[model samples]
Target: MKSLDLSLRQKRILHIMQHNDTYITSAALAAKLNVSSRTIRNDVVKINEELAPYNARILSLKSRGYGFESEDPKLIESLNQIETAFFSKENRARYLAFKLCFAEEPQNLYDLEDEMYISHTTLDHALRDIASQFSDHTPYIRLIRQKETVRFEDDEMKKRLVLVEMLRKSWNYHARRNAYYDDNFIEPKVLDFIIDLVSSNLNKYNILLEDPSIVFLNLMIAVMYYRIRDGHILPYEPPIPKADTSVYYACQDILNTLTDHLHCYIHPEELDRLYLFITANRLLDQTTLTRETAKDYFGPNTRLIAEHFLTMIQNYFRLDFSDDDDFYITLLQYIRTLQRRSDIYNEQYTSDFVKNDLRIELIIAHLFQPLALQYLGKTLTETQLIYLAYCLCGTLENFVHNHPGDKLNTVICCQMNMPFLFAMKRRLESDFGNYLNITALLPVNIKNSFDFTDTDLILTTVQKPITRNPATDTLYMSINMTEDDLARLEHLILQRTIRKIYTASPSPHDLFINAFRHEKTGHGDPYSIFRDMAADFINAGFVTSDFLNDIIRHEENSTYAICPGVAYIYSLIPAEKSAMSILTLDHRITWNTHKIRVFIMTCFTLEDMPITFRLANLFYDEAYDLPKIKMEENPDVLTRYYLSFIDEPLTP
Candidate 1:
């Protein structure tokens, strides 16, 4: 019989049908698979067609549902084979990788094809996928195929790295700990013994290991033991210069215990690699390490790297952390530890603390990638980037707290008694004291004569003032300020304050009016739009002739879609003059994964860092209605709408 070419889901449907003597409804199957009932019905039709040659079919009864009917024993044997073979492409690749890595000799193509119950073509495709995965995610390893055989060709250390990464990907935190006793890759007895031994030795040396690190360390030990026992020893390379820290002594003790108990002659080169691994994974007890004494624990270059990192943050994000000793110490410690194992990629994990602000954090992290590569000798993984972002977030919070920008100068007019008016002034001060500076508290009758020259906003209690300064915005509050009134007052204060920080003589409004361009129809892709925008920027003398290519190159490295249906693409290199070009499309164009309608391209000088940062924050704010702004057809209307986020009233 020919091999049945069934998908993993189709094969699963067959298995579920074969095990049941009675008919199984599509609803039940769908519930089991967590798919739609319609999908189950479609899968049944495809499965029946594949099983037809073997004189087997799944019968569908109107009310009774589907039943498996087969007389040929060959059909049952094929179903059993399907159960034993790998189910999905990912699993098949993983199986092939493990077989090749642990094999004593190169694996024959024919043998692998037979063992995997797949045709030669399928196995070849799987091999290509494995190679691609390694190339993209783990650059240190390679999958080599020579005619009719295949094997992994790379450094032994990198081979071990791949093995540990595969194991880590296969199991979660709790599952990994449980795998210590239940995994078949390593003997349960040996794995349990190694974990207990490492735990005891780490404790004996007064070293602390977190849960994830403990699991990772045990996996490393297990992989090293099996590989070394199989005659795969790491070659000796001269070690990098380093201080003899306490973690080094702890690693020595752990390895010495493993060597004596496992009865295997471990190589010294492996010991150095293991020490680096332990040092990278070790957590410092902050209570024991003070700022004055922490310098003693770090390498000489750590301080320089930390200072450079802070300087980059200050220069790009306009956040200064010069005097933040705690942030400085924290960054120094992270740099010292991360530099030790920078070559190892830990992209499989992410910090849960940064989910809400991941986009901004990713941009910040991308900005620092070059810095990390220059100092640490490797680009940071996503997980490490998130850790660095966490440090930046801490510094940003401190900077904002310490330096609240210029407060909004305001005047309040109320039509009540002096006592009640005084009470209202106290309320505004108590609520918005950080953002609002109340210049005067006067009666409603004197609103016309009040000095509005320096006022940023005018708040009236009874009615809207008729003769207020045209440039100064006004808000009407109720006599008894409701929750809605207070919320609106707070929002207005924030808008004015942000405007004060981001706007200058040539205001954002003016810039928008000057650079605004409208496209009634969009092109097939984002590149065309980028080209046109680059032409406009060059004509306006805002950027150089190579600005288009520069933006494209930056976009390839990092695509920024600040919000849904909007993309904010910019160049890191300083331009001739700071300028922005807005392009609004009537029809959406594909940008990365989003169908973007508004493209805001900016070319800013180093002096305009604050404006760049402010624009990013404004577009990313949840309260800013981007869809409404994009819907406006007229350029003047759209520009006003986009910049009028401050004018939008607060919703209850």
Candidate 2:
């Protein structure tokens, strides 16, 4: 039998076919591999040629596409080995990283080129790319390529950290298959033992950790084990704070067990690091702890930082959280945990279910960044920001729920009979009772005389000439409301209620009317656009010159390309007054990862925070027609198009 050499894509196709008992179509393979059908066919031809000498072939049937067929056991085993080989770029990178980290001395560049079946330049590029990826840990860990030799040098602990990150990234990819047993770095039995060891110790100590946290701990421990066995150990002592006595003992036991199993003396410094890791990852059980009692568990600094954060939130968003003891305790616990493990934990573990709320959470998190740096002594990582955002979102929900007066004072104006009106009222209450306070159910005929001064929203079944209050928003719906009507009404209620919370008085129409600029051709650079738009606001007396620098700084920290072709940028520092500016371009410019043609810039006062949410929805809301906004040439027409989605009445 001849040795079969296959390309990465070919091996992938075979791997997929091996897992699936039936033939897969060329179109399906193309879609999975993100390639053209012609490319898949060409690859299949080459794969077949490679397998011919080994008495194995990829068979293609009419319409059914491709399948692998083999009668020889030795051929099957060889194919399996080829499938498991490090052929993919990501896998190859991992292999190189592991090799460099574990190498006894500098590896010859020529030798690596031959081993990876690549030219000298290709080998150099791969090593440089790896080095760039680990550039953040520069002094602590490095991939040094001196002359024609390559080696990883620096702290053993940093090397272990890099390995853990690589493993975590790989685990994320493999975890989707529900099998980490196939991981190449650690033996299956050793990985299982490490997981069990961590789990059992936590169980014995009455400490709790989320599933993802447990997986992270297991990975860290596995990496630590391998590094220790390879004669690499933590050289310096990490400062260990006084953790829970039980957690301390648990970590001690884990290290002792590993030391005995590996027959290697694990350094005492490892225990300190492990203690911090376990404490940082542990979850506090459902038992509620008051502020005074929480201090005892999380330390006094945790309470101070949590209080400072809540105060900042109140001052910034005007939503008070001082009374929410549970929120305070939760924030304190999170801060304590964050302070301990900020260095080790970097991967994003936020669940996908919260994706809908992520936009708002991100805004809140960005707003809290300065305070996080001030109080926590370090800037929050993206993952930490997300975690903090989730906590704040919960508090915001509580604030909204607790304040009944904040709900929109709604009135239904319909020309239907008494029973029909009553049924409509019941439905509105059933659907939007949380957001709407239905104050009246009146006939449309009485619209001339009815006072809407107290009402925040007016839902009319039929469009009738009525004397309406400027503050009260109006929505037209069918007698029997459709799903679209319900959805629109829900959005209106949410926007109106949030505006009420933030005391936002300017309607969407008013906002656009204040500052709407139609640029025939926008500058190619996004920063130039920002500066130009900021000057317009400054000239109009809505903001000072500092607004330009403020927006630039904010964009640097958190870039918001809300949707495709639309970049929403706002100042973190509230403007001198509440104002908005919309700059539309005939041509698109690159903003972050998005190609943006529309820039919605705002310099809103602190009280106008909810208006930001409403503006954000102009892009986020699917019904708003982003393409229409992008394509419209006239500023007045564009403004009207934007106002069409909002419940605010248009000016004649």
Q: Pick by TM-score: which candidate is best?
A: 2
lDDT of 1 at 363: 56
Q: Please list the C-alpha lDDT of all candidates, in the order they appear.
A: 0.68, 0.69
Query: Residue by residue across 1-652, what tens digits does model 2's lDDT show?
Result: 2334766566666656655578888977875664568989998898778777668778899967788787774344444433234455655666687778778899998888778787776676677667756754422476777988988886677777677666665243223211211345687688877877887888898998766666667887888887877777787765667648998899889989987886778777888877876777777765757866775678767777777777766777776889888888878777777666543443433222233346565666667666667776656655566677777765655676688888778888888898998899899888777777789889877888888788788888887655557777788888879977897897776556555655446666678887758565558887888888787779888788777876776655445553455667776677667777778777776565446677778877777666666676555553345466656556667667676666544211
Give the clashing residue pairs of candidate 1, or none.
none
Alpha-carbon RMSD, each predicted model: 11.3, 8.2
TM-score, cand. 2 vs. native? 0.72
Question: What digit string (tens of lDDT, one per residue) describes model 1 on residues 1-652?
Answer: 2446676567567766776779988977874654568999899888878777678889999978899888874345444333224667766887787777777678999999888899988898888877866745664577777989888885687778777766655243423333111235777578788888888878877777666567767888999999999889898888754464666777777778888988988877877877776767677777867667867777778888877877876786566688888888878867876776633334332132232255444555556667777886766665666677766664644554467556667788787888987888888888777666788888878777767888777778765543446567788889899877997876665455445545353455556767747555556678888888878878988788677876775565445542355677777666777777777777776554445677778777766645654566566553356457546445566567666753442221
Q: TM-score per candidate, in order?
A: 0.66, 0.72
Quick one: best lDDT, which candidate? Answer: 2
Candidate 1's displacement at residue 560, Å, is 2.2
- lDDT of model 2 at residue 636? 67
